[model samples]
Target: MRLVKTEKTGRSVHWPTIAALAFLVPVLLTALGDAKGAEPEHRPLMSFEYDPSSEVDVELVLAVDISQSMDTDEQEVQRAGYIAALTSEEFLNAVQYGPTGRIAVIYMEWGGVDEHFLVADWTVIKDAATARIFAGQIAEAPLRQVQRTSITSALTKSVSLVNENAYQGLRRVIDISGDGPNNQGGSVTKVRDHLVSAGITINGLPLMMKTSTNTWQAMLNLDHYYEDCVIGGPGSFAIPVKSKDGFADAIRMKLVMEIAGLTFDRPSFHPVADRRPVRCDLFD
Candidate 1:
């Protein structure tokens, strides 16, 4: 039996009501490498100029959902997909294809308005080894779940992560993955507009998995909700995952596009860009 859960141990902290919230790639090496979990694989390290101040092609914050609505199986799938995407040869190639041949990235999982956890700290990915390390770091960490969905908190935390990052970037992106509408946080649209206006692009990976949750509470046409409400700014886009089988591929595709910065005329391997401008009042 599925028991309902809440993120707060005491009371939930709603950011939107307070009015002052904070904020915050790619390439393709086409290697279809094996995926690993959140554990570090013992491997030889490659030495390079380890400069803290460096320019990256993109600075990305991966903000994912870990609400109670996302069950253990779903969470495992989500986690594995990210691990696969980051470790893939295609993702590494995209990283090298960048003008700087490197990018700074962070991973975060969010649920309730007060529940945002940092899984991976800011790390630079320029080559295969570093990328492997990044993936390993996430693989080794324990999976966490919170109750409720606060996309606003996800966005707000993403902005802060990117802004405080150690490296500068030619572009900034917040790649959000979620399975439901905002039910426990401040206005999703309101915060999205605020972030987009600040010159940060937001992309989305909307999970359209069928669930037996109450229809009145479960979102209808969640892809549309994400397109119209959750993502925005220049070169922003979203890709919806319709099935468990497609989750990993969707993540890989989204990561490749974001890393490539494919505004238009994308290659056959990449998905087409969406020209729709996001609006703040979409869910209302």
Candidate 2:
């Protein structure tokens, strides 16, 4: 071993010092990697964490229902619809229509009193690649279910989740989809009203499945119930699904509508025939 001298200062670099740096280079890299939350490799000898901030036209929360009222087959159809919509070329095109060309999305599957499960955490979908990756993740997630329908719980959870997130947006929305009424939680109207008044929109995807059921879980005029109670905000509306086969198309239309921020004039999603108004206070 020999020293590499510093000619300008006439100082000799010792072999021991050179050996010490050689030994610590990898260790230092690993320390930097640990500073980040996680990485591909647990102990990365070298890595970089890129944290870039972005703006978007909206922050949308896809709050879906997994209550038993939706049978396993209907659940499957609903899940499939979202996967198709999220990955569709239309969805990708909708993203580009935004002012910033990106949006933050959160996906939740809920049922029961306090039942809220995150199928996908906060993710920025800016391009086809990112959209596909998100769609694949949701496509692969295990289908889950619980008892009861708590629209109130879903609303509360969504508000908390959005408030705790890191992204800032010009608009914030909770796209709540459910097949039944509020049969299991706190006051849905109160929570819905609070969120709407705070400038956070609540959109609805009122699914009309199990329409003929004679059980306590059955909800007739769910679409009207949603309009009277659940959805509210600027440009907010409910696009009801009338059957299993129409689920995907409904999902796609709604996604494109929300992402593009299109009004009733958008060809993809036309309004359903208006039903007579229901009691917004029916659930209390």
Candidate 3:
């Protein structure tokens, strides 16, 4: 992965090269058909080597923010955090203790409705080597798009991706990490409610750090906005990483909680005064 300095923001971020995979003509045809609003294509006859029926306990999908606000430095930290978590001994232990000793994840970057890119899809990490390969692939993929933050789109697409997996896991989760609130697309509250009701847990990593003294107040304001509208479902909670340095710790903690399926006592950190529950009715 090459770290690139953002010209506009003067921040350095790691940019990874894309890996080329052999394309099957039939698969391409199915994708084309789906794009044309035809009937949904049937599942592929081929499958990954990993055994999904071995009772895998958890399936985690990470939805990361690659919006314009996240400068190169911040994005690098975010990417590194996930890489470290996936390769960590603790995470592996959690996976092994489960029935299948496996965890499948889809790495996606999202900004707005039209800006979701699947960097990696449903890679089952059963060993250290597999985990490293997944991480390396993520590190090499370039940032696909940049727009406004749309937490709703990320959550919606994530739910769809997880359902597409054939793994029979005990738990399903969508880990969403963002440094800003939803300012694009439809209402986030509506999407949040719909996903939560579908029995998918939604956890959040909200970056509250300020890049400049002038942006501190604005960042703090947005943090509160996230606490209200962006997190929900069983064991759902938002952990604030006050700065880039805290990214690793926050990510580690979130991963452990997800693997263990731990529940939170309450939503403790409220950054805004309108500490009301996120209600879709308000927007309607």
Candidate 4:
């Protein structure tokens, strides 16, 4: 059974009414990285002079969904996949290739409009040892499920988290992973557009392992929804996970791309560039 609790904000947003609200035009984003298909693993690490002002190369918020729609088994797979990716050789190598060789990360879970929980606080990971410690904390943390899906609330909280954090980075990114669309809280497209305007990049991981026609929340072509409505800003992209086994690989690839600020030309990687510009009324 899914748990229900009062929202901490003490406010409720009607989804239908909120959806009707006008959306701001999104700012065009410049693509990051070069045309050469340079994989992070193959890139050579270069020495960087440490600037006290910029502590890390990127500040990343890993916002994962924990709504009742995701079963316990699926949740475990999701959690495990992150752990594996963080400790993977590719991720560690990518960190070293960065100018700072360090990145700040926050792992958070969200469900309803008010159900954003911080599983792991902002931690700087520069090497394998620090990465292991961060991964260990994630592995030890308990998982809980809340009712409803609210990508809007999650993005709102992510922006706030980035603003509140002390570490300054060359890039700010929110890596959002979810299985459903926003059926609660305010309009996701509005919040996404706001983030893009503020120069915050948003990437997405659309979990499609359990897509079904019977489930109301299990949306089809979720990757399209993410690309067209959820993600924005420079170098924004969405990678859909069609099977349970693809989670780790997809996550590792996304992290490497974000940390190294590079994009691969592989077919599996979907960059939101050179396509139609994102519109506010996508879902409607």
Index of the highest-TM-score prediction: 2
RMSD of 3: 26.8
Report how far off residue 257 is in candidate 3 (Å).
0.9
lDDT rank order: 4, 2, 1, 3
Give per-residue lDDT, candidate 4, residue 280. Answer: 33
Comparing 3 with 4 on lDDT, the higher-scoring candidate is 4
At residue 141, give the lDDT of candidate 4: 91
RMSD, every candidate, angstroms: 28.6, 15.6, 26.8, 27.7
Q: CA lDDT of 5 in candidate 4?
A: 43
Please rank every candidate by TM-score, starting with the best: 2, 4, 1, 3
Q: Write the per-residue lDDT of candidate 1 for residues 174-217, one digit (tens) a residue.
A: 99998888875668888999999888999988887764454633
Can you tell me which runs of candidate 4 are displaced by over 4 Å? 1-54, 212-219, 264-284
| Candidate 1 Cα misplacement greater than 4 A, ranges | 1-52, 211-219, 264-284
Alpha-carbon lDDT, every model = 0.81, 0.84, 0.77, 0.84
Report residue 84 deviation for candidate 2 (angstroms): 0.3
| Candidate with more favorable, higher lDDT: 2 or 3 | 2
Error of 1 at 251 (Å): 0.4
C-alpha RMSD (angstroms) for model 2: 15.6
Q: What's the CA error at residue 170 for candidate 2, in Å?
A: 1.4
| 233 Cα displacement, candidate 2 (Å) | 0.8
Indicate the TM-score of model 2: 0.76
Query: Please, what are the lDDT tens digits per residue for candidate 3 over residues 156-227?
Result: 889998888777678889999887767777888889889889898888887777645537436345455566
